[model samples]
Target: MVNATQVSFFTLSAYFDTGVFKYLYFIIIVSLYIVIICANLLLIVVICMNRSLHEPMYLFLVSLFVNELYGSTGLFPFLLVQILSDIHTVSAPFCFLQIYCVFAYAAIQFHNLSILSYDRYLAICYPLQYNTRMTSNKVSVLIALIWLFPFLAIAVLISLSVPLQLCGNIINTIYCDNYSIVKLACSDTRVNNIYGLIYTCLIVFGPLSLILYTYMKILKVCFSGSKQTRQKAVRTCTPHLASLINFSFGCLFQILQSRFDMSSVPMMLRNILSLYFLTCQPIFNPLMYGLQMSKIRSLCKSIIFGKTLTDA
Candidate 1:
């Protein structure tokens, strides 16, 4: 174990003996990264170029897509390089940076979904106020908060983490997660552990409760309210619900992986489960929103078939 001041690198524990599959892994990961970029960027471009798609819902979607890009980028670039090379090592600074990006990305998803729940709540539960409540300025401010709050929350965790004297230089996982680094610290980590739990509760349950309540109200309205209201809710809420479910599964898988000893599981399965959240969400979210929402779908189709993307 190197002293905190002297330790400059960390070796990931999850880089298994792929042997001949290194090249194959490299090709697959590169292909996935490219698809993630293209899928998300296409949807983002469609949203930004068309003024008609500019609203609280679409704006929130743009933020979600941006999260996918930010989150995926934090992983894929480094992953691709590592796959091509023999080194399975990362510098302390880069490791910490990845931790920040990945943590912030995960935390912000909860907030984004929470804000979206509120947005949907207003739009469906209180239509007249929706216009006033979800104005351009409000949406912009909320978007800023969605990004800012998570950064600051995780920033505090990372700040506490920076001063820790690590007991080991190897991370058990493929990526630099907050808990993985904290686990390696030789210092008394009661404070970090407690704080991490509280933060997790706040990030997870707070948004989850809000999302459930909002959706519950939306559901009641769907059952009791007019036909038009039910149809509208179905159209708007479906993608958000789908995205939420997908993200929740990823979060659940991550929690289970971190909390339990999964070494007995097959190595390939373990890697796939651990990395699913980081990789799959990035690919799935863009498709969830792009294809499910008719307007964006039409815009994407037009851009593809009409070849009028240059104007966009």
Candidate 2:
């Protein structure tokens, strides 16, 4: 039987031997990172600088952008470095930190979407109470809890990972995922897997179900109103609904694949889907809001021209 020490050593050795393909993958990933950073930064700037965008919905959007920025930053740079360099190794402490950040950001994202859905639900179903219930203080507290709760969960998960002895050399995916890393262990992973599944279901599916149910109710409320009110409600909820759907779907595929064994899928196919999920959301978000919401498009254009005029 492969012992813990052997597993760790073997995994490290195999990781270092990945050749030219790693560098090529790194370049592609870096390009995607640049796009995600620039797009999200622009979105944040537009929301902040435009007085018109200083409303509840846009405020929630800014929060989403912030979450995505941290999420991508936490996961991508480390993967890029590993791909580009011969040093495909991470210390146990750093590994834990990485896992913590990745999972924390993911949880924050899940909660953010759920919050946004609830926000829309109130806006559509109880317009008069929306402002009072979703007061600035309330929103702030919710956002804080969303970020903080995830870190606590991650701490517990990391503790579970510490006792296991890892003895593998190959990471099947591009990055150091929790399951992928845990699989390297010589210890029985049944408990870890079970706990991981529970965590994922709570973090991913729980929020997702809430979002879906809230939106369904919101839609019913919309239809119950007059044509004008219905149209207005639909307009308000559409962007959020689209974004929520995209985020949930992307996360579902990413998380499920990350948790389960991926031995059956070809490496190339796995890499492609991984890249799609990782790169697509950040890029897709701004475009979706920009094209679908006229106010955002106007703000973006105004900012571009205003910058040009200032520079000239």
Candidate 3:
């Protein structure tokens, strides 16, 4: 093997214990990835084809579904190959690409959720104006912005990272991430660190705060109104709430993993927790929403089994 002085490839140290059963693990991982891809694509197609679902709520959902595919594609294909291989090394450019994709995925997830919450707020609190307010053109612009903001923000973040001089190239995680890559830099990464914190606040916590305020307003209006209104609010918001909680847990895992000392945590458990955001949220969001939302659920049933079932 021809050798160079600086690190050109990063050997992922997280897969150290995957010995004889790597093939079995590989199969399982590939199966899950396929499932996430199929589910997201199906829902996206359904939303797009049905004119009834072309409204702001479903449009936002379709955007999210697309992002799920975007995020999963970044990790799963590469991950499947790594699971079956002996040497788990990633080239430099590929690592940075993964960094961009994963960060953008997570950032956009929060933005999408925040947008959905805002839609619900307007719908429930000011139903008569919802149609006027959330026009098709306006929704289109919002959707474009939702995708573009993260793409640009993370692009800047990745560009800043591009100039870093690395002291090492071994990442201690199964997947490549911005912070993980930054930790290997030879020079002081305080700028990157500060930027990351600010970026996290802008993307994750900022959106979360807005969502909370929206929910509080929704709750206020629901409680002040009739029983029917309360029920309607609950029906529409429950699935969103479920998704928010699930995604929050995944985000929490990522934040904790990056910040805290996970040495005492079992390796298998750590791997699972680290993977939760990427592995679980993609499948969970659409599944939970599709089943809970009557229109999408019935549409799915009608298309799948040739007849829609009557609501009991």
- Quote the lDDT for 220 in model 1: 92
- In candidate 2, what residue range of length 10 has the lowest lDDT sum? 7-16
Per residue, candidate 3 scores C-alpha lDDT tens digits across 42-114 of 7887788888887899999999999999999999999988888889999888888998999999989999999
Show the lowest summed lDDT stretch of 10 residues, model 1: 303-312
How well is each residue in 1-312 modelled by candidate 1, as lDDT tens digits? 556777799898787777889889989998999999999899999999988888888889889889989999999989888776677899999988998998899989888988898899899999988888788898889999899988998888888888888888888888877788887888888889888988888888988999999999999988999999999999888888888888889889888877778888887788888788888888888888888888899899987787564333
Is candidate 1 or 3 superior in TM-score?
1
| Model 2 vs. true fold: TM | 0.85
Alpha-carbon local distance difference test for all models = 0.86, 0.74, 0.87
> Candidate 2 regions off by >4 Å?
1-26, 188-191, 259-261, 307-312
Give the candidate number with the greatest lDDT.
3
Error of 2 at 97 (Å): 2.1
lDDT tens digits, residues 1-312, model 2? 445444432223323455767777777788988888988998898888777677777888888888778878887887777676676677656666777877777788788878888888888888898889888898788778777877887787888876777666566555556777787777788888888888877887888898889978977877778888788777877777777777667766666677777668766666667655456777888788887888788767877677431211
Residue pairs in candidate 1 whose N, alpha carbon or C atoms collide under 3 angstroms: none
